[model samples]
Target: MSDNFPPPPPEQPQPEPERPVPVQPSPWAAPAAPPGKQRTGLIVTLAVGGGLVVAGAVVALVYAAMSSVQDSIALPPRSETPYSEPYEEEPYEEEPYAEGPSATEADAKKDVTITACTRDPQIGWQSAKVKVVNGSSTTASYTIMMEFLDEDGVKVAEGGAGVVDLEPGASAVKKAQGLGEVPPGTTCRIGDVWRTPSDRSGS
Candidate 1:
């Protein structure tokens, strides 16, 4: 029977139970990182840091450019000056000596007598009226030269008046003015007188 049927297996021995090993902690040992999650977190952190750096650089550059532009277009400093009050101007006044009669009116020749002499306030001139008498029997024309003398008796100005076509024993009135301003307290006199043939008819 042992030969024909495989003899029953001999009884097997039971295996012993495994015991937990005691592990020693190393001084340099650290927490082990999760492979997938740690890598992803490190990449995100680097990206954020890089963006902040770039943004800071860009802001610095922009600030530098603006400062440069402002400097280039800056205005010059203004100079300070002392202020003073304005001065008033005086009005003009005319001298009293600006009025008088011309020399021609005061000293006419014997043929001419000055009847009136005056200073015109409006025109600022010396004027005179004179009467010329034709003493010659024949018709004649007469000219009288006048001189204006300053207070010192120096001749300062001169002028003349004339009458034309005077008949014998007839008279005519003439007017004259000085060429220049007459000095104050100046005297006027007839410097000379002359006669010429008159073509005019009887008086």
Candidate 2:
């Protein structure tokens, strides 16, 4: 009877507690970088810096070469005085002309006409120019005489004594030199007559 009572008490069941599931790490988590890869990036940065330094040196050398080339070029020396045309010993001659009308009258018919004329002051002497017209029907020969006068109406210098011949309806030029000094005056005039030395001294 005691063995049958103990077997009847073994019928009660027992319950177990619930356990949580284990989680796996994310796939996108950063990995440990390789030492060789890190060293490669450092080498690339150093190479870029070295290349920039080389480029800067090359640019500096180029600039120095250009400056040296510029300095080596030769240039002519400059002059302080204003330049003028060289003086010629021989006087200029004009073309031959033919006479058609007198140069005195304003309405006189002329075969030739004066084109251009000017004058320039020199350091020691004064220069002048004149153009003459042939106003005649036939060819004629003539001479131009320039007389420089002082304020007292006295002739000082004389220029142009050579003969000038002009073709019909042509123009000519006459150049000459003076024997005395040039004087200053408010009024100026062009004349055909030339005063001789004896005549000037006599007056």
Best by TM-score: 1
Tens digits of per-residue lDDT, candidate 2, 104-178, equal 333222322233322334533333455555565644555555555667877666555333445555665554455
| Residue 102's lDDT in candidate 2 | 30
**Cand. 1 TM to true fold:** 0.42
For candidate 1, the per-residue lDDT at 200 reads 48
Off by over 4 Å in 1: 1-108, 199-203
Q: Could you tell me the lDDT of residue 21 within candidate 2? A: 75
Model 1 weakest 10-residue run by lDDT: 98-107
Model 1 Cα displacement at 59 (Å)?
Answer: 99
